[model samples]
Target: MYRVSLFPTRDLHLSDLRVALINYICAKQTGKHLIVRVEDGDKAHNIDGKDQELLDIIALFGISYSHLYYQSDNFKYHLQFASTLLDRKKAFICFCPDEKATPYDGRCEHLSPDEVLNNPNPFVIRMKTEPISDSFVIMARNKYPTYTFACAFDDMLQGVSTIIQDEAYLENSSKEELIRHAIGYDQAISYTHLPTVHESEKSVQWLLDQGYMPEAIANYLLLLSTPTPTEIFTLEEALSWFDIATISKDSVHFDMEKLGFINREHIKKLSDMELSKRIGYACENIGKLAKLYTKEVSTTLEIKQKIDVIFAKKEPLATFEAESKLLQELIFNAPYFEMFDEFQAYLLEKSNLHDEAFFKPLHFWLSGSVQGLELALMYPLIKNYLKEIVR
Candidate 1:
């Protein structure tokens, strides 16, 4: 199993999704279990219901897991392992009062058993700096098990054979390996460190709320600095071709423009009825109108906004106000025609106005925009709703 550990301390970010995708792919590619472990051990930092929200987001992106757990649930095992390491002399109880102390001076490493028992000062459990690893706390002054301590033992206990972690945690990799080694676990654990996606204001939820489809987001994320057979694919489809080794070791930046293009492509793939529903109507005509907006926009919200402007009543520009009133009056009394050309020819003859004078104000009156989908093509679709469109 390759497990993903998420801390419920902050809002979920792109980096979290990257790691989760790697962990999920590894398990599916090997016929093993995908374990999602919420590292919510720090009670001071855990958010309310954020853990469940995180899982819901993952599901929204279509990532399924074989197992789910919380790191805090294994508190008993973490402490038990700490005592086991202390008894084996692979770890020592440190009396160092400085919580920020690092590269420890080994002052308390030699206290005799009676001296340790007689001493009343509070202390922490630190793994001995073997030739294999540096010294760090397995238990902190607050009595909470440290991340490395819990993660290392959990991997061992859960039989996790691979770990895809961030490059920032490169230093912790050896410490975790040492913890397992000192505890006599010889099973090889593969470690692949990926460069982190730097922090940004746009989070995963932010993208969703902006009307970017989940598939498009996943598609863009999986394509970042990674070569694949195609530019667009769903999370489920990516399972067939994803390879963690192909990911670039150098840090990658988020490209909003590239994601916008991918999102546009995904939007175009939607059916007419589905597209219309996104804009708050079920009629295929509205959906057709929505698709026309796709030529200039990518997200569902943008397309919906454009289509909504057609029906929202608005006054025409001052220059065209008189002509628009004439056009609206003409449309109100005019009988419905199946074709736009017939409708336009009739208006031209009745109004006795030339093409630009007639069409520009007519366009502005119908959709409240001087530039957009050509009036002729859109007229037929909005014909039945003339009473509502004419005002």
Candidate 2:
């Protein structure tokens, strides 16, 4: 049974979501168990309601966990485990000042427990690390277990066979291992260190506020994890293709352009009715416009704005020599046909001008750009615009 952990400390951010997603995908694909552990061992920094917010965000991404645990709940176990290490002489209480900036130097390693108890100074229990090792000593201060101590103890207690953590926690692996060895736990918990999601620029919430969809963010994150050329895929598709060995060790930078491209692709896949529902308004001609203009838009508001722009009259840049004749022909023939196809045929037959020159100016006048929805889809809107202006 593989057990993965999602450890959110404080307010969840894009980096936290990224870690949760990577672990969730791995555990789901392997048909293993996923555990969500709120690492609130540090009571000083723990914020109320942030834990629920993290859970809500996880649900927003459709990720589920088999078990939910909090490091703070196992305080007794952690303290008892620390006491065991102390009893075995593998750990010592440090009498260093609480405000000291220097690292613990095993100053109290030789002090007896009676001496430690007799001392009036507040002290912290520090694990005696191996000599000539880069691993830092694990500390438990004021009944609060350090990250390394709590994590190792909880993983063993919960039977976590696998630990997926951020690469920033890579250094703590040795400390955890030493704790496990001191505790005489034989089974080794496999560790997968994922690269950090760089948030030095814009944060995830900022992107969401800017109209980026959750689907786009997830797809972009999956692309960053592996070297696969496939850009657009659903979470289920990503799960089937996810392989832990294939994950890149190098840090992944955020790409806003790629996210926009993915969001546009998703927007194109929505049905006209679905688009209108998201747009939060209806127009007599919005259904047709939604299908026609969605390819160029990323958000529902953008679609609505584009539709409004299309309906609103735009002043012509320069009156063409053939403009008077074209407008007269359109006014006379537009009422004869209800469908755009027939109207288009009528315009072709009546106008002596070339198709590109005759239509390009009108297209530019209506949309202020030549590149937009096909004129056939814009026919009704264009006719309405022309009628108001011609009067």
Candidate 3:
């Protein structure tokens, strides 16, 4: 059993998705139950409808939870456990007025229960910590339990066996462990703190806006932790190779270059029809371009731009002078090949002149770009562009 907490702040980011994905993978591979807990106990920071938005985001990534819970739902139990500590003389009510005080001095530790009940002042509950240790406050005067108290109590009550979180929370593990011991819970939940994703200037929304695929994002995230030899892979293939023990403890830096490379690889995997559908979502012209090229394109904008180049009213670039003879020959033998196989045989017959030097200028004239789809596939598109230009 594992429990992962998501705060569902108003401005959600990629880091939230990264944490959720790691936890989901861990639970799935280990055959353990996973609970997604919305940490809404701190109502002061909670936003309206943010919880449902968080759920929507989780579903967007195709992650599923065995159980869903809200920390606020167990508020009564949190307070009860804090009170239990008081009854067992493990904690006391501090009447101190200073809000900035740290390592509480236990000023009200000697106050009797009757005195605490009768003398009601704005007070906070402080754990009666031992010497060589600083006292910590678990509940404020407003009766709202601190994050540490609520998290620990609920983890125990909910039978959570493992806790997965970012490295920033490693400091709080000790505080939570103390609360667990104070509450008389013997079994300690295993802690696994995954390395944090270095803060990126580009937010998650920005990446999506730039036409990145979700699969590529997930693949890039996994590659940051695991040493996958290949640039592209499906989530199922990645899960088969995922091992929590192999995750690097050092923080992972977000590399946009690597992400773009992975995205290109994923784009290449899509069938032409599927690629057209995705392009159509962006622009119908791009979808028609996909049908014209009959090959994979890295982005919708790329295909659209290529189509514009082919349909430009201006003549092809003057740089095609070196291939002028080849161009005239291809035009004169206009209907040389109706099928790609016949074209390949024709190229094989002129193997000596079919090298990169011969093809490079031809590609430049046809696509306005030096690099593009294979000649076998691009032949038809180039012929069509030539016919339009001649007319």
Say which candidate scores most in lDDT: 1
TM-score (C-alpha) between model 2 and the true structure:
0.75
Per-residue lDDT for 223 in model 1?
88
Error (Å) of candidate 3 at residue 233 is 1.8
Model 1 lDDT vs. the true structure?
A: 0.83
**Least accurate stretch of 10 residues (summed lDDT) in model 3?**
280-289
Q: Quote the RMSD, in angstroms, for model 1.
A: 2.6
- Each prediction's total of clashing residue pairs, residues at least 3 apart in sequence or on different chains, is 0, 0, 0
Which ranges in model 2 have alpha carbons more than 4 Å from their true place?
1-9, 98-103, 132-140, 199-201, 281-391
Prediction 3 TM-score vs. true: 0.73
Q: Write the per-residue lDDT of candidate 1 for residues 165-270, one digit (tens) a residue.
A: 7787888888898899998889999999887876456888898888888879888878887999999887778889998889988777888888889998888788
Listed in order, each prediction's TM-score against the native is 0.90, 0.75, 0.73
Clashing pairs in 2: none
What is each predicted model's overall lDDT from 0 to 1? 0.83, 0.70, 0.71
Over 79-145, each residue of candidate 2 has an lDDT whose tens digit, in order, gives 8898899888888777766523345455566887689779998777777765522324456447678
Ten contiguous residues with the weakest lDDT in model 1 = 128-137
